[model samples]
Target: MSSKLNIFEFSNPSIRTLHISWVAFFITFLVWFSHAPMLAFIKEAFDLSSQQIKALLILNVALTIPSRIVVGMLVDRFGPRIVFSALLFTGSFLCWGFAFATSYEMLALFRFLCGFVGAGFVIGIRLVGEWFPAKQVGVAEGIYGGWGNFGSAAGAMTLPTLALLFGGDDGWRYAIALTGAIAFVFSFIFYINARNTPKGSTYFKPKRSGGLEVTSKGDLYFYLAMNIPMYIALAVLAWKLSPENLGLLSELATNTLYVVLLVLFVFQTSQIWKVNKEHLQKGVAEIEKYKFKQVAILNWSYFVTFGSELAVVSMLPLFFMDTFELSAVTAGLLASGFAFMNLVARPSGGWLSDNLGRKKTLSVLIAGLSVGYLVLSQIDGLWFIPLAVVATMCCSFFVQAGEGAVFAMVPLVKRRMTGQVAGMAGAYGNVGGVTFLTVLSFVDASTFFMVIAGCAALCFILVQFLDEPSGQMAEVMADGSVELIDVA
Candidate 1:
């Protein structure tokens, strides 16, 4: 494998995979967020109340937290090619359902289902990890993640105009269905072009299927402990939609969902134990062992970085509009800068992780994220608009860059479990979004910024405990022969 990446080298199979894989991810995001930009048209068409609109927003992310983990496991078992292609194809139908829904209930159901599309990010993580070497995986994964993430921004930039051009009450519907068509077509394109791994390279699979295989009994408990926050985040979302809050869901429905979540968590716990019981009892070979805390710390790091990005993107436009007394269009255009930075900022983080040590790079980026948010906590209407925009962009750079750094280490943790590792970290990012957004519900803008900064500071400290990836990981092949994969 070459130490240097020539992104323009299209003839290279790995480069081709990187380009097509990111486009697959981008289309999923485009479908996932297609509703957000055209919400005004839909609201007008359906006569939605403020509370109902809030419910739609909450429902949009309701399934994504768990879906990411599920997709991760699927990617590991089935490989990225099939799993990603299927997700894109299926997501298109959901987009169409949401676009053409005649009733609010129908709209809510499809939007919640659309949350599955967001898990498309997890599939590419495993795909990109397979194609790139340890030396270049950082930036390669960065370009995959950073550019793929821009799909949401791209949708926001273009979809509204598209709806307007379609020119009627049903224009939003047609515009959204068009996004679905692209996803459906691209699904076939990705499937036909993408390969799971390089020629002659083995695609390692997990020894057990159900849950992540932990090394020690202690790590087994730690893995279980780490999952509690994800369930808690889901519960918070349920509460927001419950009759006591937005009244979108009746008390009976909310309680039933709560019971369902509890049952699912118990079933998941058993699956984790099932996957690890035999291994822990036999005692894992030292050479085959990897620390579960590496996974845990990355989870928290992503929670701080990507989680804050989701929360901020949702609120920044409103924050700017109110704070500066600007029109909606003006505030929205200004706020777009934060998301726009992903194209460059994320790849730069990966480049730094590749050149600088991963741990050091991650730590510095997290610290920068903390400081950036702290600086944001001080912004006010008294500040000039251009300066505020610059401050917001600067803060987003660290947030998104930290996210890139987190995933850069994910594939290195356990080559076989890269899908699951990426999935868990990706899920935690949503957990962070839910947790922080919940905080924003009760606080001022400055307080919300301070809360994120405080959490980033704690994550910065946790990152110090990470042992740098400097050696090789040993994987047992199907024939019981050992294969060594490089991490450093």
Candidate 2:
């Protein structure tokens, strides 16, 4: 595949696939977050309490952590083309249901279910990775992620105006339903237009199903250890919604959810062991071994990068409004500059990774991320508005670009399991979001910034252990032939 990509090259199948995949992802995100900008209207309409509002926020992202993992595995098994379309199709009804929900309970259930749409990001990772070659995959994935992610911002910017255009108590409902309608239409468009691979290229599948396969017993343990954080993040979210905290969940309900999480974790661990046991017992070939640490380290990298982005984006408008004494609209616009950077920064991260080498590029960006957060830790009433906005955007560039860099390495890790790898890494991003945001509920904004800066420091240390991709990786064809894919 050529390294050059032209956005206007609609005649090219690969270019066309990129456009379709990104649009599918964009619509999912728009539908997923469409509830956010119209929350004020929903609150008045439903007579929601402050606690109920906070519960809605928590519920929105509640399912995403596991859904990404499940979606990732599905993509690996069924191919991105089907999984991507199916996810969008399923999420559309959930979106519409949430839109028309008449009660808080109905709203909470659908909002939690809508979290499934967040997994849409995991699907595009594998799809773009398949369509583009190693030399260009980074930028290709970056463009897919960066531009596609704009849906949230677009929802934030446009959804309210759309509601006003509809003009009534039910206006927000129609606005949200319209997003679902678009998602419904595009799911079919994606199913028809997206190709799993370029004609004749093999679509690889993992040798075993049920769980991610690891090479060594040591890696088996490491993979299991990494799974704990995702559970812990969920547990923490439950605790946040428990009677003592936000009081959205009754104590009995919270305890039941905790037990459910524990049971699920145990079940998942067994599935993982079952998947890797035979190979570990018989001793796998050297050629098949890839370090699980690569995935673990990348998980933590995203934990800080995209995780901070989620946590910060949620709080930024408030942070700006309070610290800078700006109006809600002004603060929201300035805060949006952080997300706006995703358009250029993510692709730039991928392009730099492609050109400068993945490890080196990610390292520099992460180091900058640490610095950026530390600077953000100092923002207060003393800072000027424009300067603060510039600082926020600069930090976001490193944050979102770091996310692009993380996924750029994901597909390179394992060819057949790119979906699972991206899925776990994607799940970790949500884990990070939950973890960091939970931290925010306790501490002040400055402390939250410092805590993230501290996490970024840890990521910088972890990135050092990453083995840069080079030479070639080997994958087996169905008939037992070995295919070597160039990574350098």
Candidate 3:
């Protein structure tokens, strides 16, 4: 609970909890992304076409948008301990399946399934929020997020070396399978070691499940409206794979998906109304009511922050290679500075949020994010490579820190619903990624950066509406007692 505790002091249970949780998250990411660096080997082994390769890449992230939402609901109902373990355990098999696939169809299916592991990040957000007090939750969540996120970079760096070390046409399979093995072993370790909450602390649960609860009729409407984008992102992915685009999905299949999405949206709206209609009809007491607007704002903030990060990181190396006329290795190494900033920048953002006011910190970061991307939009062939890298790193720092700052306020919104809140926010991050990437496919690099900058600028305007967390959040215990959790 003390923000001042030495981070390495594992003697403290909370610190130990934070360490374990992040490691669980890290392994999930390692498994989730283990294929990225080994894609060349995979393509060679499967004799895949350029279109199939691109389809594989798109399929990789396709499931995570909905998976995060489902994982969030599950973690809220069943607790992070079991949910995280189950995700990693199942994902490990998917990893192995992808590793040893003899055909592109098998590879694509497994890779798509592996996207479920990305939801592991959301589970840890709730876990860290449970163990750490408000004074320290931001930094704890930041450390968890920042460190865990590095697993992708780690996989990218190490998987290729691992493949070569194995030395064969199937080397990539062995390398990827090793990542799955590690995830499988660690799943048991995480389940055995992690606790739902600190000793004797009540593990809060949502009063109902299926959809997020809303206090006001307007909020209910807002919650329903927000769900639309997630579905739209899925539809976009489907469209990208359809006959008109990459032709991965037939026209009939794509149309079926569209119809399915529409039906699901209607079903989900009904669920939302089912869960919240009684609460809205009776009116929520002010003490018991929390603003859905906070969740909405955080969703948009993450949409731009983490969303842009995803979009940029995907294209940055190519951007550097083309614009700077550098080799793939050098460009990739330089571009990695963007992701590498996560380690320090995210924690700094969270620490700033904890010490400074949350709204003020987010405002400054979002403003900087807008400016940073606007600067990036100007980079060109004539720009000095060092200066371009500096500009990229600057933008990355704001983008990642803004992610930290957004989640810093997530747990503060509603304690019992932290998983759902984090889930929706996390899903929006993917929505942002899908949206921005779809935009990128239609535009040039500078235009893409400008679009992201424009989105960030809009998010900056929205951040002004966010009410800072103060005093304490009230949650009811199972025994009909009120417990106040600090947010101030």
Candidate 4:
């Protein structure tokens, strides 16, 4: 494998796959966030209150937590090519529905559905993992993630101007609908161009479909325990929208939703047990067994890395505007710097992980991020604007780089279960966002930053327990033959 990335070498099928996969992911993000920049217009059109607006924001991320898990299963089963295209194609309608929504209810429903596109990130992780060799997988996944993730910033930068170009009360509607159209057309393009795997390589599927397969009884319990936080995050979202918070849901409805979530958790636990019981009872082959703790640590790592990214991106603009009394446009432009770092910082993180060793690179990045957030916690109205901007951008780099480093290790965890693993980790990223943002509602900016810093410190400690990937992971072929995939 080349130490340098020759991304322009399209003659290489891996390069071509990398290019197309990132574009698909980019468009998914663009479509998923198309409504964000247009929210002001939508709010005006619907005459939405502050609470209603907040509810819409909550609704946007509400479904993505579980969607990643479900999409992971689908990706592992049907492969990324079909699943990603389907998600984009189906999400197009959801985007369009939100665009032309006549009522807040319609808008809310469509936005909630649009959240499904957020899971598209998990699909590409599996796809990229399948195509790239382990030596290059980290950088490849980083490029896919870093560049593809820029779609949100792109939407923020362009969609509002696009709405202006359309010129009317409904301009925002047209702007958003256009994003859907792009996604709809690109879905076919992606389907046509993308392959499940490189020629002559097998695409491994999970032995069972309903839940992640576990090697040991302890891991089975660990997997189930890890699931609790996702449900708890959902419950927090429910509480936020309940009568006590935003009043979007009545007590009865909130309680019903809680019951429904509980029931689903029970059902999922049963599925997990059903999927792994035989394996646990009989014991997994030594060659086939991989540690679940790797996944758990990565999950927490993402919870802090990508989680803080989501949470901070949501509030940074406001934090800047409120703290410095800056113009909204100026604050927004400055805040955009945070997301823009994804382009270079993420890939750099991946490259570092590839060369510097994954665990060491991730730990260093997390430690830096903790310190970065701690610095951010000190920013106040008296701070120099230029200095604050630099501080913010510096922190932003580590936050995104940490994300790059985390995913850099994901595919190597278990090749056959890459999708499930990525799904869980990706879901935790959303969980982090929800948890941090929820904390923000109850505290000041300094406290929020400190909380994230604390989480990062804890994650840094937890990451110490992660064993670096080496040797090869064994997967069973369709004909029941075993093949070894290199991880080191």
**Please, what are the lDDT tens digits per residue for candidate 3 over residues 260-326?**
9999899888888888988889888787899999999999999999999889999999999999899
**Model 1 Cα RMSD, Å?**
0.7
- What does candidate 4 score on TM? 0.99
Query: Candidate 3: which pairs clash?
Result: none
How much is 146 displaced in model 2, in angstroms? Answer: 0.6
List per-prediction Cα lDDT, in the order shown. 0.94, 0.92, 0.91, 0.93
The alpha-carbon deviation from the true structure for residue 234 of candidate 3, after best TM-score superposition, in angstroms, is 0.5
Q: Whose lDDT is higher: candidate 3's or candidate 4's?
A: 4
User: Please, what is the TM-score per model?
Assistant: 0.99, 0.99, 0.99, 0.99
Question: After superposition, which runs of candidate 1 have C-alpha atoms over 4 Å from their true positions?
Answer: none
Question: Residue pairs in steric clash, candidate 1?
Answer: none
**Model 2: per-residue lDDT, tens digit, 296-315?**
99999999999999999999
Say what the RMSD of model 4 is.
0.8
Query: Which lDDT tens digits does candidate 1 get at residues 292-384?
Result: 999999999999999999999999999999999999999999999999999998998998998898999999999999999999999998998
Q: Which candidate has the top score in lDDT?
A: 1
Q: What is candidate 4's lDDT per residue for 1-488, written digit by digit as tens?
A: 66677899999999999999999999989988888888889888999998999999999999999999999999999999999999999989999999999999898899899999899999999999998887888899999999999998999989999999999899999999999999999999999999999998998899899989989998999999999999999999999999999999999999999999999999999999999998888878999999999999999999999999999999999999999999999999988888999999888889899888999999999999999999999999999999999998899889888899999999998887899999999999999999999999989999999999999999999999999888999998888789998888
Collision pairs in model 2: none
Cα RMSD for candidates in order: 0.7, 0.9, 0.9, 0.8
Candidate order by decreasing lDDT: 1, 4, 2, 3
